[model samples]
Target: MISWLMLAQAIALGAIGAVVAIAGIMRRPFGDWVLGAAALTFLTLVVQVVASIIAPIAGAGPTGDLLEYWTYLITAVVIPPAAVLWALIDKKGEWSTLVVGIGILACAVMVYRMHQIWFVQVA
Candidate 1:
């Protein structure tokens, strides 16, 4: 993956996570803002998915285990939607929001791992 793109994803995810976290801490219910943020975060992961597909073709192939890299990417892509679904189903309000926040934070970490696999780790 491109270095700048990876960094941007991290920052974006971090900011999204923080927002969700604060809302949860403030005892806010799952609302439009949270849903919108989660949707945006998921869209960014979709973008990352596309970038992952195209990056290798552009000769930015990963130097680490391809399986590991793909695993992280897939998990990162899945987290937001899964968390959002859980939030929608559960009526625990802030707790559900917290779950989404945590999930997004986890996705940020996974993205960093993907960066390592793509550009830092040795096969």
Candidate 2:
């Protein structure tokens, strides 16, 4: 994954999360925002996956073993959909909010992992 793109995605996800939190605080229904965020994240992951696949074929520097990268990629792709689905099932007050919060937390963690991967490569 491109470091700049990863960072951009993280920032976007963070913004989405913040919007979710604000909506929750204001007692607004944020299901649409949640879904939108998930869709956007999914799109970003698609780009990351394609880039990762092509990088090796283009004879780029070591990224890591394909299996290891795939593991991270799959997890990144799965989390948002899972969170959105769970949120949809939970109509109870604050549950959806919790889902968004958790999703945001996961995104933050992924961003850190992406950074770590880049750091390892640079070292």
Candidate 3:
């Protein structure tokens, strides 16, 4: 598990969430460009998750609680797309932007936790 890389990923995700939330707060719709950025962020998250899994299998991953690590990983993997997909389906979706931001924030938190579970041993 690469601490700095994961930290950067988390920060990027958090920043995306902040941007989305700000846009939503400003009464802006979840437009195409924001969606595109969200998609790219999700892709980055996917890559990070894959690399994390492989690292453990390669005997280089975190040695903490496997259950916690996997839970965080699974949650991190699912939330973004699920939220966006649901938002996209709704006809009105007045709150879609905010929900998407919340979802992204959740993913960021999960990724950060996963990084901790993999690299920072709890005392």
TM-score of each: 0.94, 0.78, 0.88
**Which residue window of length 10 is worst by lDDT in model 2?**
60-69
Q: Rank the candidates by lDDT, best first.
A: 1, 3, 2
Report how far residue 93 has shifted in candidate 2, in Å: 3.6
User: Mind giving the per-residue lDDT tens digits that candidate 1 earns over 16-118?
Assistant: 8988988787778888888888888888889888988998899888899889999999988889999999999985654988888888888888998899888
Q: Please give the distance, in angstroms, between residue 38's alpha carbon in candidate 1 and its true position after superposition.
A: 0.9
lDDT digits (tens) for residues 1-123 of candidate 2:
567877887888787767776676666664666677777777877787787778767776444455555677778778878877777877566668657656765765676575566446443
Top TM-score prediction, candidate number: 1
- Candidate 1: which stretches are off by over 4 Å? none
Shift in Å, residue 105, candidate 2: 3.6
Which number leads on lDDT?
1
Cα lDDT over the full model 1: 0.87
Residue 24 accuracy (lDDT) in model 3: 73
**Candidate achieving higher TM-score, 2 or 3:** 3
Candidate 1 local lDDT, residue 13: 92
Q: List the residue pairs that clash in candidate 1.
A: none
Ranked candidates (TM-score, high to low): 1, 3, 2
lDDT, residue 31, model 2: 62
